[model samples]
Target: MKGVYDIGGIGLTWDLAVQGGRVPPVEFSVDPRVRHSFWALVVGGGSMYMGYVFDQSAIQRICALPTVRQAKLTYALTTVVTSISFVTLSFLGLVAYSYYTVRGCDPFKAGYLKNRNQLVPYFVMEIFHGFPGMSGLFLATIFSAALSSVSSVINGLAANTIEDLLRPAFDRYNTTEKGKIFIAKISVFFFGGLCVSLSFVARTLPGTVVQAAIGFVGACAGPVFGIFLLGASTPWGNIAGAASGLVVSLVLNAWITLGGIMYGRRPVPLPPAPGNFCHVQEVANITGLYLPDPFNNSTGYIDFSTSSPIPVAGIDSGGNPLYNISYMNYALTGWLIAFLVGLAVSLATKHWHEPTRDERLLLPFVRRFWRLNQADELQQAVKLRHSGEHSVEGPQTQKRLISFGNQTSDMI
Candidate 1:
């Protein structure tokens, strides 16, 4: 009842429109220049898609499945479940907005909350205050989520470090099983402590925890995903190309993220806090104690005029075009730059490089094309041999011959 009215009364809204030339951090305006415009959010949603496709942790789990069909099923189910969670969370955002709208107060603009990210907890507390254990349950839920994320990250870091960095040294030294176990434990502690220290450092950074986290992850993910894409899709990508792409893309993403944080302009003030509707006497009747004005004179009109020229939409507050790109585009930008640079480098070094002949390494579509070409070339070679004529040997011919010999040996 009251919940139904709360949702139905307000419905959906983009809040107040930006007046005068000021650009708000979030808006549903038609302008493509706004950082959080509808178009940007639509595109930024791809970041999650990119995460799903390129995330090593998820890939490792999928690979561990007993069969290819099982792996595919697991991937599909995981994506669907994760997407449903995201959609539910998005709906909750609307519910929070509706609750505040009905309450005739905005916690953030009223100075009760410093950041919008705090709104969830505040909303939970406000609604669950009368219920003795509900607020505590919400707190427990938060802790559980935090613990799950932290534990997974720490474990992944520990596993990666041991497998990629320490395994060779252990093998070289013929490390005992107990010694290996002890070192692995030590690595876990070391990584856990390191993650804790980094969290403190993150607190010192600009932007909310959500921004900093996604930016950091997007920057890292972009390059690594690019490398994986290159290796899987392109036969010409050699170690040099992969290395260059990884370094260049990582540096590019880091610069964009850091520059935006350090130099970005702040969003203009939101529309003035909703008019104070709570009366002092009414508060006394409800809680048996008088409460002062909760809004603290927050009704002042926003002034959009400023000395600096109005920034172009989509650009950060600093008016710089490059750094202000939507964070969602970070992974995509890295992917493109990496692919282009890698392709160029691979072509430049083509004389010394041998394209991978393993069909298993190529994408399914690419492998199909490879097989077609292989069959065509094999027919041509046989015809030339029967005619007792020599054809010019090229890199493709060499690769085809090697591939054919391997396949023949396997059949035998």
Candidate 2:
């Protein structure tokens, strides 16, 4: 009776979400801009953080493995785990929506939600509030996860700065190991401080928090993924080609993402309606010109029916249609641009004449191919040298060698 009352009081339909009849079809029309944002999220979310996890930390982790086989195994395991995590989170979102819809507390329609970003937290509270400390525990878990991510970012920044920039200069200065370590420590401190400062600035940055996150990710991800792909896959690629590709990709993607943000399109074609929650009243007794009306700051609901469109960003006053592509597609655009430009530059120039790269530095599958090619070349070289030496050998020695070969052939 207690359990039934609890379930009834909380409006729990725990198993209903899985049934087709109990749930709305999870489908909607998305804006082209939202497509880019979605793609940005997909690519950005693929292996954790694109900047650190893909570029710096993941490589370090891979290299730490005992063998190429182990590295591949690690990647496979990571993929499985991350896929599960993504699916689980997505399902949670669906569960939240379903729960709200069933209870007639659909936040989107009720105009009760102040920010869409708050939906998950609000849902967690609603579901777990009856259970003492569960909500707090859940929040703490989320906070801990965030802290881990920030730590990773700091570590990655330090490692990259040291390896790519600082160490090179320190090497030129004939710095000792201790000096290098000192520099690394300094780099970590500097970057950590910078990150702290930026966190504060990020609070004031214009636009929705989610939009800013995806935009920031889209800005960094495309060019990095492109250049990393080029470097890892192509032997004929040079710094010049990669730099050119990366620059073009970054510039193009940034323009598109920024333009997309400025021209704010709704993801769904049918914007959500605030179902009759608000009623307007005449404010005929307004005193001062500056204080005509007061709006409740806590509300997430806004009526845009009579509001003017946001002022356009970029070259044209109305925003250039050319740059209206979604931010999510930025990664794809940047990657393609970089790869094509990089490949063209590499092919059109002297990169083709460059010496063979270390096969070990590439994927393990390609390593055997390179080794076979090297072995074949070495065998050919040996054959050519033997043929030259054969011409200079005495007739008696040639006869003896022929006799030995005949004997060897007979034994076989």
Candidate 3:
């Protein structure tokens, strides 16, 4: 019973439930600058929204559904579930904070943790110390989850490479089925190694894992999403416009992201847990445990009271404003820049060109209200028949063509 309650508190509420007492209002962000900032949160949300819209896994799953109605329902349900999970995780963070506040101990400040990411693991170990084998089980679970995610990503990349890039070459060379299998096996190993090597590079980057990962994704994925949106929503975009826009956005995002990481102001954390309340000062005095003062120039007795907070270093004081903006803005800015540049370039270069006749390529709203000349419609149908590139295929394509003819006749 004791183990169950302890594990539950640590696992779910993160020590708060075990404490069995009053819980304080959670402080949202340790940094006062970012706390309750509307623009910061909104931009962050925009990044996530665009990410979902353009995510390959999401698109694949949605397309796998048999019906459009089922796809729509799945998307809505996923969003709801995701929102609830996010809220729950957020509350758990609050619980951890409240527990630490009550305990009068800050692990990072106390030198128990070297990195910010270690806090969760440290907390888990602390609570589960009494329960033998449970900690080992928790660790195994974590490793398994991580391996599954990593393997899935690697497999997808390898599969895409073989199917899309190497298939034509293999076909041309008359590569046997077994040879293709061998090549795929080799690709998996190659990509797996490449991924592992990149992880080492990531370890050298500044800031927390969340910031680095999100910033990198924003620099790359944001532009791709922008290009997708441009093609789907607009009629004038061409190859030149998309290429120019993508290149410009990529360069811009990379510059901003790199500059921010290298030269931006570091966020100051909230004040550490009071040493007096934590009895750290008393213990240090009794044990004669003294740490060197980092800031003190004169040789004197070290003041331990204010020694727990991390020293802020490498702050780019009075630097470029663009380089100091929030990381969340990376995606939003990238997307906007790409879309605007693409549209401008497209309009300037191809103003007189005909728009796409394929209604399937456009958004539902755009397709619904679109009207074309009878001649243009007739030309499109003929082109579709020649190209054999109708959105539907086989028998369904013929049915759709007949239905389209009926609709066109009725409109006339």
Candidate 4:
């Protein structure tokens, strides 16, 4: 509720300012008899939130697994199922929207793509009329997803705080489950509250929800993904390589995005209605603007709509088309850059040995093969022991078994 209010306030403020103090009002022009139908559509839209909730639940279930293999399998399967479901639902939503639009309903018709003010109407419409019975179900699913994510975050914080931070300070307190739970809950609550508050600030930022979310994820995850790849794929990948990759990715992304913004190249499009209306003829009529003759210095707003049919190409301040780069490609570029840089550095510092033992232990499927070898060795030792033969190799074999046992225990 607080988040909703904050977002609404911020959006409304921006909308008014952008329109030069004129609040561009959205007036619904529907038959009074179809008011209930409108509400139904709004309610149906609210159900989409359930998909998010289901996704979170699936993630939680996967994370609860003790082994990495199980977790990976669970995650993969769950993701596929959830993704399919989302796609199907989204398709249905598009169909429904098309139906409504054909019938003169435009629930999602908002002025600006970036501003929250435009989003508010759509949200309200969804809540009121989107899905009838499905809205609550979707909302519940969304709540579950939110709670699940919050739980995982709390769990991660608890693990890090206890194992890395608090345990080092108070060894005796580390063993207490209740104490750890309390700390985790407190941390989760505090962080969650902080996040909600910060979201209000984020709402004021000039970008669409999808773009903002994806950009944020890409910015944060790019270096982390690079580091993980380096650690997993190359023994030569050192702290220096990881650090370099992180720094380079961050700097490059920041420069590209911020530079674009500073130069008036907004990543997201502005409002499309009266706000964006411009006279093409007026723009072309300015004599000095793009005149072939330097002597014709008369300056006036050329009404482009009435001028010559030639289109005026308007390039953003960054000297590029606003929609030139697809966001997926942009994010991929960042990841690829990070990966390549990290790999190059790793190749340059080729000194570390492969973590074969750690790999075998960490990978359960590989560990199964390792267990077979151990079993063979154990059988060989047993055969020698039962033969009543005191060969020099028998003691060595027994000693090897003991060593193997220790290694296996340590791995476990």
Best by TM-score: 1
* Model 2, C-alpha of 409: deviation from truth (Å): 24
Worst 10 residues of 1 by lDDT: 13-22
Q: In the order shown, what is each candidate's alpha-carbon RMSD?
A: 5.8, 10.9, 9.5, 16.5
CA lDDT scores, all candidates in order: 0.66, 0.59, 0.66, 0.48
Task: For residue 226, give model 3's deviation from the true position in Å.
Answer: 0.5
lDDT of prediction 2? 0.59
Over the stretch 1-412, how does candidate 4's per-residue lDDT look in tens digits?
2222322344533442333212223323232112113432232222222223223334456567899798767657766886797665444333332222222223334322345435433443444453475556656786797677666665655566656677765576445768767776787677778767867976766655545554454545555555655555543466767777878977776565554434434332322222112233225455435422211224232122331232222434346442333232334445556778877876776555222334432334555665666667667876776787756566656677677667667757
Where is the poorest 10-residue window by lDDT in model 4? Answer: 272-281
2 or 3, greater by TM-score: 3
Q: TM-score order of candidates, best first?
A: 1, 3, 2, 4
lDDT tens per residue, model 1, 1-412: 2333433443332231223222245566644335567665665546536655666566667777889999878778877997798776665655665555444555665567776667778877776666788878878998898888787766666677778888999999998889877888898799889888997887677656776776678777777777778888887788888889888988888888887677754444334334334343346658877543332336433222322344443344446766667665676677777877887888788779877767799888887777666567667766765675546667776666667767645535
lDDT of 4 at 147: 77
How do all models score by TM-score?
0.78, 0.65, 0.70, 0.50
Per-residue alpha-carbon lDDT of model 3 for 1-412, expressed as tens digits? 2333432444534443323322333434433134224665566556646766566656666778899999989978878987796676566555655445444456766677787667666666666766798778878987897788677666766678788799999989999989988988898899889978988887778766767877787777778778887888786687777888889999998998888888876666545443323356337657988733222325242233553444433334587867876776677778878888988888887855545656677887766555454346556766878886755457854765576676577667
RMSD of 1: 5.8
> Which parts of model 3 are misplaced by more than 4 Å?
1-36, 167-180, 276-317, 348-354, 372-407, 410-412
